[model samples]
Target: MSAFLSARRLALLATRCPRRTLSTTPRWSADPWPLPHTAQHLSNTQTPSDIPPPTPIPRPGESEETLRARLVYQSRKRGTLESDLLLSTFARDHLGKMDETELKEYDKLLDEPDWDIYYWATEGRSPPERWAKSSVLEKLTIHAKNEGKVVRRMPPL
Candidate 1:
């Protein structure tokens, strides 16, 4: 009698529960939900690229303290990881001691592409004529060499 009751209960539960079917569609469909008209237009028009914008020239009468802070931030936030570590560490070690002229040169250096700067710093590629004579670049290359010291991480601000 107990076995019969158990069978009947199983039948009832099976009938009451709905069967689930696997979806034929992919989990990530190519079809995205509709966007607003303006957004759709912008999305279609804009293509992503790696180029960074030109760094702005220093404002007239900008204070040295403010310039140093800005350079530190830019150095720390360079888009590529290699450049970020190298530049941030270099800035921490050098920026405070740099005068207004040197700071301006460093700011211009920041405007160059990350790979170019990284290669130049590491001595993997020769810098262009403009940078070849720059004292700032010389200092950066010296810092990047790391010599006997290993630079495993970025220095704190």
Candidate 2:
């Protein structure tokens, strides 16, 4: 009888069961799984039972970081929604303010090798908009030539 019982116990132990197969009074066999990643972490290390329910997400007004995000020019502060979106999209979120043509050019320039267009788009400063700046069309012209393709001229912006 003892040998048969030992064999049964070994059979259960040999199988790869995910849950605890052996349970004892006042103590568990397998340890509890670690806390889930989505579980809210409290600043305190209180017992599991003492842990409070997940915290509620603070409302917009209750957030400090959201309130501090703004666009500034010199000493002036620009806090409108459009300005914020522009600054964020182009660089941080301020690129949305450029005129339709500027935005179209800005979109194309986003793929350029040099970072100047992105820098200017996000910084709210267009490097003088001079011929020396090498517009997106000019850069595309150079790229097409490198790839042995001909690019037709785009009407001047």
Quick one: best lDDT, which candidate? 1
Candidate 1 residue runs with Cα over 4 Å from true position = 1-55
lDDT of each: 0.80, 0.35
User: Please, what are the lDDT tens digits per residue for candidate 2 over residues 37-140?
Assistant: 21231112123434443343333442323222321221022233322333232333233343445444434443322323323433322333332364543443
Candidate 2, residue 94: lDDT: 30
Model 2 gets an lDDT of 0.35
Q: Which 10 residues in a row give candidate 1 its minimum summed lDDT?
A: 33-42
TM-score of each: 0.63, 0.19
What TM-score does model 1 achieve against the real structure? 0.63
Per-residue lDDT of model 1, residues 77-141, tens digit only: 98867789989989988988998889999999998877778777877667777789999999999
